[model samples]
Each structure stands twice: as structure tokens, then as C-alpha cells.
Target: MIGSEKLVARGLGRSYGDAAVVRHGRTVLTERLDRFLQFDARTGVLECEAGVTINALIDHFLPLGFFPSVVPGTKHVTLGGAIAADVHGKNHHVAGAFSRHVRSFRLLTASGAELECSRANNADLFWATIGGMGLTGIITDVRLTLSPVPSPYVSVRYERASNIDDALELFHADDHRYAFSVAWIDCLSRGGSLGRAVLMRGDFAPNELLTARQRHDGSRRSPTPRLSVPGSAPQFVLATPLMRAFNAGYYHSHPGAPRTKVLSYEPFFFPLDKIRNWNRLYGRRGFLQYQCVLPSVGGREGLIRILEMISSSGSASFLAVLKRFGEGEPGQLLSFPRVGYTLALDLPNRGPEVFELLERLDALVVRFGGRVYLAKDARMRPETFRAMYPEFRTWLAIKNEVDPDWRFSSDLAVRLRLMD
Candidate 1:
């Protein structure tokens, strides 16, 4: 069902936008090539086909004590997709991006020649491919470092923050106590409550930390999703009033008394994963997931302005997440994480109004030295993209040098003018 002049490799199509779609062109579905090539239990290293999904990893290897060191909100993503997007999770402030754990990968270039890429061999290609979003080349296989966990349980702490300031303070003052941390914010709240959020932090719970029943239970393997949305939800179900109510319910549900509890890993990391086809809840128009990072210098102020703008505009996102990102390889050229705050918002496709609000948000992002995550972007202007990611020039030079004719291109690349 896919064929064209310029091609882009697609894995699972969970990128939320045109990154994986080729429009009228050919989109080579890489999922069929999924396979596990090698595994080393002692070293906690895994080498597998690029098409392998995070869900596949946990299902097959989590029981064996190995897990991907980095993951996104959902596990329905492929290893190649994770590396391409340079996905980050609650552990970003600690583990950095997904590329940090990737040992090496095999790249199939536009010239039909295969190259072994890593920090050592074809190093430039390796960095470019890390977060290149399939614009660099087609990654066929990857070798990644995995973390060894005692069990599939996590020790979690919940904190209630009055606003963005309190959340940031808690993150800075308490994040060192855990391995993973994130916040679910209410974008519909204005005034002093502009950033009211629930700060959730966690670390893999040790065997000794788990209760005997929870520990000795033989069904300790990954649990399958028990619920699904079934079909698209009516657009009216997510209007501002309903979303505000939902956000209110979520905020109140967690009194967040700085409590710590042991829970299974599935819900701790991938809560939305329990519900299949959950995206359909946004309705037939779908939703735009806007994710951007603000540098440490003006991050807080920039973030506040953003939240305030969204709240005042009456364009509330159903899911708003905030997190801190630590340092990353500055020389990598294309990765998204910086040492600062990052926010992700999911807004319903309410037509022109949504785009207008996003444009206003873009101005703030550009002024604050922020860049949108290409993996989640659906409607970003070329100028805005360039302003946000000046490193694109560096990555572009590498892409031109490798794929001069521009054989590797996607709808996203065309929209952002990455090839022009």
C-alpha cells in the first residue's frame, strides 16, 4: 500500500505525526523484519533487529532480569524508533536520552552499502542517526545496553505541588533520591494555580522491598493490557469543560502526602499502555502532541508563560507532562534533550484555533532557546524549526555528504525543509 520516489523507513507508526508517513511516497514498513539476534545476560547487553518493540523486550527479557534503560510513555515503540526519536522517559534527568544506552547499530545507506556505526566506527553517522528521525539512514539492527532489575516492581513517591515553582523546587531538591521522576500538570488552571501538578518519582523496587505475596507470586511476568477504548470517542466528550473536570479529578485523586509505595513496573512507567487504542479518545480528528524543551537559563519563566497562555486561550490539553532533562552529548548535533525543563501537551484537533495557539506558543519557545521534538510534531513551520534547532545545519551537512541525492526523506523532512 506504499510506494514513491523518496522513501522513509517506518516502525510501528507511533511517532504521532508525519515522521513515519511518506504521503504519496513509499513507506517501507520495518516491523516485518523484527527479530532478536543476540543477548548476553551477564553483561546486560542486547543486540536485536531494529524493528523490535519495547513491549517485545519486556515480554521476552524482563522476566530474565534485563530491561531497556530508557523508555517513553508507551511501550508500543520500536528500538529503531526510540533511537531515531532519541526518546526520553522519567529517568531523563538521570539516564539522559535513549541514545546514551545504544551501543551500536547497522545502517543501510542510500547507496545500498551497509555501514557499522557506533561511537567509534563511522562515528559521525552514529551521532546523526541517534536522533536523526530516519533522515540519516535506515537502521537495520542495534546493540543496546540494558539495566538489570531484581524484579518487575517500582518504589514510587508522590508529591503535590501548588504550581510550577513548587514542582521545579521539588524536582531539584528531591530528584537525587530516585532514579525516575515526572509531573502531570493541569494546563487548564490559571492564576496562582497555573501549574498545579502531581510529581511522581520512582526507582525499581528491590526483591527485598516487595511484600512476600507480591514477590513470590508466580505471575510476576509482564501483565497484558486488560482494557481498550474499542472505538473513536465523540469529539464532544473532550471539550474544555469535560477536560477541566478530568484534570480536576486527576489532581484530587492523588492527595500526594509525600508517600512511598511499591507497585508493578507496568503501571509505574507505562500507565496508558494498559488501555489499547487510547489515542482514539481524542476523536476522529486526532490530536496534536506538542513536545518542546526549554534551556535552564529561562526555562522556568518560559514554561510559566506557556502554561498561562494555554490556560487563557481555552485550548486545554488533556494530558500535560513536565520533566527535567539532564546533560547530553552536545556534539551529537540532532538529539533534543538539553539541561533544562521539557513539557509535552496533547491538544484535540479543534481546527484553526489549535494551530493559532500553537503558533503563539512557538514564539515563546523560540525566544527561550527551545526546540520541538520532531517525533511528536505535526505542524511546525520551517522557520520555527530552524530557530529551535540550529544544529540542523550540522546534521544537514552530514546528511548531504552521505545521501547527496536525498534518498532518505519523509513527510516530516519535507514539511520542515530538512532536505532543502
Candidate 2:
């Protein structure tokens, strides 16, 4: 978005903050850029327009024995957005973030010039764009190294952890054996019962692991409904009582039993993708996803402080996820990955009280040498943001070189003074 002032690079509009919204500014909707430019089945290397989504790629290539090397929970995100955020999946403990799998790409800057960036060439620009959040330029095309898969199905195993300590041991013990993994922690629990969790781990299934019917229809396309949230929902729908009930039911539904089942890529990676406009479920007030990663060294103490803060403040979140992330590429000045446990929470925007509590959480994050995910953040103080992303100065230097006039900007950029 930075180059040529065409400054908006949009994916599925899935980002839960003003980062993806242009407000009154000009925006470039990259969804229209969804098209495969090239593919090499042998090497599993593919090139596509910036707007290409993980879901679209699966539909066209799964039958050919290919899939994203690393994918977040949802496959609806665009290639450009993934790079901009340097998104990670459950397998992060093994493969790191998305940038690792990206070979190279072309970025169109405000001056109407297309520049190639990669580890060996334009290394600085490459790093800045990796996690620059689209501040340096718009991604016109992307070249990524895809991964070979056995079949489109994954063999999944679920294990329940009695508490936080058990969860840690289980994660460390089994992470290497599985290609992908994640744990759903019960953040609402208190005292000795706190941090109870469910661990889900899986690897792509081999041909012999599949049933006759699965092998035949491994390419079958799952129907995706096109729908948006209703204009409004009752404000009372997201009250504390209802949220607590929902959380309780969600926790027990996955009792952590071991089950080896053949699951398709769609259901395993993009369960939420099936529900279009699911955000509307939060109602007219909208919602906010507060996600942060704390370094493992001090992260434990920081997490306890953060959770305790949230519990004491009485903030309610319908969805909360905790995952361990491996080291990531150094580019993308503001990327959100490191050696730590990251947590993401979905809270209905209830007003000033919640924001106040979040501020406290931010303080704890800062104290623990952690940072929030810029892509998912809607509310954060400018000072805190600067402190969290030390590379901001380096990103600014490059952005200024490309967009000195500041034509490419978002509400987030303005709020954080990214263009100043």
C-alpha cells in the first residue's frame, strides 16, 4: 500500500482492527488479484497474485499432492496478508512463521515502481516488507515454496491436560512427533484448576492411512456459504453470564481423548472459514481480538500477571487460544512471532471498561519483554506500540525512502505515527 499511494492491501477483511479498514482513505482490495501465476508440482514451488487465498490454493492443488507448508487456523487469508503479518500455524513449533516458507516476491511502491525483495537481494526492503504491515508498499505478486503432502487428509490425535504444568510437558513431549499442534486453554479457570487445556495434534495422512472413500474423493470441494452478519444483534447476547456458559460448554466438548481420525484440510485448518461473516455474531458494537506474545524466559510470569489482570478486571472473551511459536525470519519490522506462547482473545467491544483493562495488560506485556500482534490490534497507546516494536525506527527509515510524502497510511499508522 505504501508505494504509488495505492496504499491499501486487503485480504479477507479478517483483521479485527482498524489496520484493515481505510476509513475515508483510498484502499486497494486485493481479493481481485486472486489468480495462480505459476506452479511447479515437482519442486512444490508456486507463484500467485497477491490476493490468492490459502482456501483457493487447496481447491486447485490438493488433488495434486500439495498444500501450504504452514497455515493459520483459517485458510481464508491472502498470501499478501500472511506475509504482512508473518502469520503462524499450529506447526509453528516446527516450521516457524509464514515468512520462512516464502522464497521471494514483488512489491509495488508509491512511485509506481516494482521491486524484487528476498534474502539475497534488497535484503533490507525484504525484511521490512515481511512484517511491515504493508507500510512500505503493495504486494503485486508472490512466490512461495509450497509443501508436498501425502493426501489432503490429516490424522489427528487429541489429548487432555489436567492443568498448566501438564499441558507444558505434553506440548514439549509431542510437538516434534506431530506436524501441527495447538492447545485450547481454559482461561476462565481459577486457583489450582487454572490453565486446564486440550491439546490437538496432527500430521498429513499417508495414502495407506486413508479409507477407500477418502482416497477417491480427496479432491472433493467443500461448499463455502456466502453470508454476512445481520445488521445488528441484541446487545445483551454477549453478557458475562452467556459468555461463561459458552466457554464452559466449549471446554468440555473436547475432553482431550485420543482419537485417530481422517480429517480433510478444510475442516482441520479452516473450520471458521465455512461461516461467512461470523464476526457479526458479536453484534452491532463489533468485537476486538487482543493477541500478544511473551518471550518464554519471562513469559510465564507475564502470562500469569496478564491472566490474573483479566480475571480480576472481569473481562469476557468468547474465544481464546494459546500456542507456542518458534523463531521467525528477521524481516517485517513489526512482525508478531518469537520464542514464546502467544494468546489471542475475542472480546465483544463493551466500551471504556474493557479498553482500560487492556491498557493494564499492555503494561504487563511491556514489562515481560513482549509485544502485541499489530495486525489484530485496534487499540494500543502509541508509546507502548513503539516500545513493543523496536524495529519501528528501521521500518520508518525504509518507508520514508519509499514514501516520503506519507500518501500510504491507515488509521493504525496515524495512531502509531508510522508515517511521521
- Give the lowest summed-lDDT range of ten residues in model 1: 1-10
Give the per-residue lDDT of model 1 (tens digit) for 1-420.
122268789999989889987766677789867899999999989999999999999888888887899989999999999989999998988898999999999999888888999999999899999889998778999999999987888888888898899999999997877899999999998888789999989899888888989877624666677899989998788888888888888898887577888998888889899998888888898888889899999899999999989998767766889999989975577788888999999988899999999999999999999988889988999999999988888898899999898888899998988877
Which pairs in model 2 have colliding backbones? 1-7, 1-137, 1-138, 3-109, 3-110, 4-109, 4-110, 127-331, 127-332, 131-332
Q: Name the best candidate (by TM-score).
A: 1
| lDDT (CA) per prediction | 0.88, 0.80
State which candidate has the highest lDDT: 1
For model 1, state the Cα shift of residue 135 in Å.
1.3
lDDT of 2 at 192: 67
